[model samples]
Target: MNELLKVNYDSDRITLSARELHEFLGVKTKYKDWFPRMCEYGFSENVDYRLVAQKRATNNPKNPYTEFNDHEITLDMAKEIAMIQRSEKGKQIRQYFLELERKWNSPEAVMNRALEYSRKQVQALLQTNEKLELENKIKDQQLNELKPKADYYDQILQSKSLVLISQIAKDYGYGAPTMNKKLHELGVQYKQGGQWLLYSKYQNKGYTHSRTINITRSDGRSDVRMQTEWTQKGRLFLYELLRKNGILPIIEQN
Candidate 1:
């Protein structure tokens, strides 16, 4: 709650500027002279302190910009140096650092840090999910842009091959009854007494043919029936007609 001296808690370590510490403690000796004397107390470089650059004004018109060496000493080193000072300001700064360290390592502080880490992970996951959703949307848009062209190619290739009504229905993810019903609704064909036949307008388009089948009824009476089958042209016609009405085979669906 009170500021005694500036403390740096960056670089994954708690540290203090040695020069700032000297000025705060009101040391009468020059920093260049005082710091060397402090180092004589068996303190090690990079372990007890790290060398850092401190910019300075040379106070000369010829070379105004210059630099001086400084050190960022760990809190433990700073506490020891304060004790070595054996002065009123040194005692105050040392006690301030002790209290700060106690609070920094408290259980409440640790839990807060863990919660902050969890929040960061959740944010990262949400960002990743958003990216994937955008990618899928783009893919769907590209597929929709190309669907009509792909369906045209499919019709060209498939219509060249003879196929059964049930097989064609299967390709569209439906059954014969559904296909027949759809074709009937579109005026492409009609159901007669016992079979489906092309409408009069489409009958002479070379799209279909009727085959006569001889079968024995369950009563052992012989009967003849007409089975109408589609040609490749008829299948292609159906494809274009269905596509115009916004019905598509499974292959052409998004």
Candidate 2:
């Protein structure tokens, strides 16, 4: 609003009138707070506030101007004054002003503009977060819907009725170890019971049913049975096995 002050937007520079500089440096006692505190550190007002040759010539010439405004102040002039006032006590104040000027004119302003752009991008992401979450939920529901049908096919292959490991190996056209590994991957369990029974399912003759087999242990001491029905004991045993192996998935209770 001051007539003698002009701000250049393209250069980001401010031109200050002599009167404004005098007022800012507190040449008058009314605005003492605006004065640089270096005035206390051997910074006599006479040395810091002086009239430049150009500023001396005014329309009146009789009353030579002794002050210059912020725009009239150059970077070199500010640095020179700061260097003269350099002392342990004034170091912080000097550095503060130096850094303030550096930030105002340096590439940091560009960085701040970039930071503002990134903040807007983050705001946009947050705005659509709910829609993204809803899409994820729909995908999860579709996965859940297809899960039972896949489980049905898996049950047919791992039927508990296929007692002997060799039988499952024969049906699946895989080796015993491969069959065992497949069953292990599918979380199939074998139970010791009245007879050697196989409980895995096999898709045969256009129908899927539990396959059963009767067999004796190699030692003749125990009979084993495999089944698809997951019992409380079976579940507990499976849970313990998985826990021991560190493969257990967390189960939520109703």
Candidate 3:
């Protein structure tokens, strides 16, 4: 491993010793001559390379007691140096360094993978929500299908001699004003002489039924007033008449 490359981890970035890189590149020339020539290629200091220097004794015997500067360069600077060298070894070293870089795991790659995983999770959740919404819609349709039978049980099974005009309108899901409008279209006028009366043609058909009630006020004045009402059969007759003329009861929709 030392012969090929000596690798180090610093803050998750891969670094190589400058002396080891020079030796591995097998440059026969002095490092001082090679280093300055590579720097002239415009590689910025501290970005492509970080130099670590210390004072060292000179090689001269008389100057052995004195000191000189020694330094190191980074892997980027080494790659640039390898590219410039005109030798088969330099080409081999450059290829090997590229392979190392390709194999390295980066923080950006990890973050991108995490984002992709989150997107998949969100897509799955949306699909599930759409499925649930469709299921709920099906349930609502089924409930609507059962509504007419429930209305029949209330209107027919619970038989009564008479049902108020207001109750009949409610069962058909009509307000008083809308019901009056429909009745008017059928030639039946309401609350005249306090009685629901039909026009000439419908009068003989007996589509309407009413009764009279006598009431005495506190002043001792008694009066006979006709109260408007509908029987079960009368209610059915009106329902059919209005429906045939393109006016349908709400239950018919279900």
Candidate 4:
């Protein structure tokens, strides 16, 4: 806890630098020679301690960098090495390590660790909620952009009123007479004595409705005639028929 020998807490278990431990214990032998001998006393390689390669500047300038090996031994192994030294410094280090092990496993330390874990979980959940909210906002914007088209299509389907030929023709960028000529050319209608009528093939198809109208000419005489108007179904039929011929309404073209 007071930085006695720079212990490593990066791993799940506490580990000590074996070279540092040797120096602190005042071993007579050099680290390269002393560490191997310490391993000989029933200490396994990776289970008790692991080797770490490090680089440093050398005294000789010609070979400026040199690589050396150090070991990270567990607390249990360090304690064992300290006891084997049979010195006052070794006893003191061993006592310090024992205290560290006790505090590290205490209930207070465990509770602190649990609270830290819960804090991290809550932070992660908050970030996820922000992301979901952003996604929903984008989806709502997309639906809003499509709403006008949906409303227009619904109006077209629900209309029950009859439309004049001129009105349908205007939608297709055509005047009434031009539209009639085109329809006659397409074999859908024919010009009779006083009016345009659907061809025999298209007659009685519920595409048109005849309304009787009384007209007064410039001669002060009145006349009765049947005026043909297109129903919604007939308008839709003309839309499809004209669309196949590469014709489209102004609204559709826009």
Point out where model 3 deviates above 4 Å: 1-150, 204-206, 216-221
Model 4 root mean square deviation, Cα atoms = 9.9
Q: Ranking by TM-score, best first?
A: 4, 1, 3, 2
Q: Model 4: runs farther than 4 Å from truth?
A: 59-62, 117-254
Q: State in Å the error of residue 43, model 3.
A: 99
| TM-score to true structure, per model | 0.45, 0.21, 0.35, 0.47
lDDT of 1 by residue, 147-200 (tens): 866876666576565566777687679999999898899988888888998888
Model 1 segments more than 4 A misplaced: 58-61, 116-254
Every candidate's CA RMSD: 13.0, 18.2, 18.4, 9.9
Whole-model lDDT per candidate? 0.85, 0.45, 0.69, 0.86
Question: Whose TM-score is greatest here?
Answer: 4
With candidate 4 superimposed using the best TM-score fit, by how many Å does residue 206's alpha carbon deviate from the native? 40
Model 3: per-residue lDDT, tens digit, 1-254? 22377666443456776656666778776767766667789977777666765556677887675543334555666677788886887898888777666655457756765677798889999999999999999998887876774675466447767766677677678876678777876777645754667676656554456677899878999988777667677777776777688765676664
Higher-lDDT candidate of 2 and 4 = 4
Residue 234 lDDT in candidate 1: 75
- Clashing residue pairs in candidate 3, if any? none
Among the numbered candidates, top lDDT falls to 4
Clashes of 3: 0
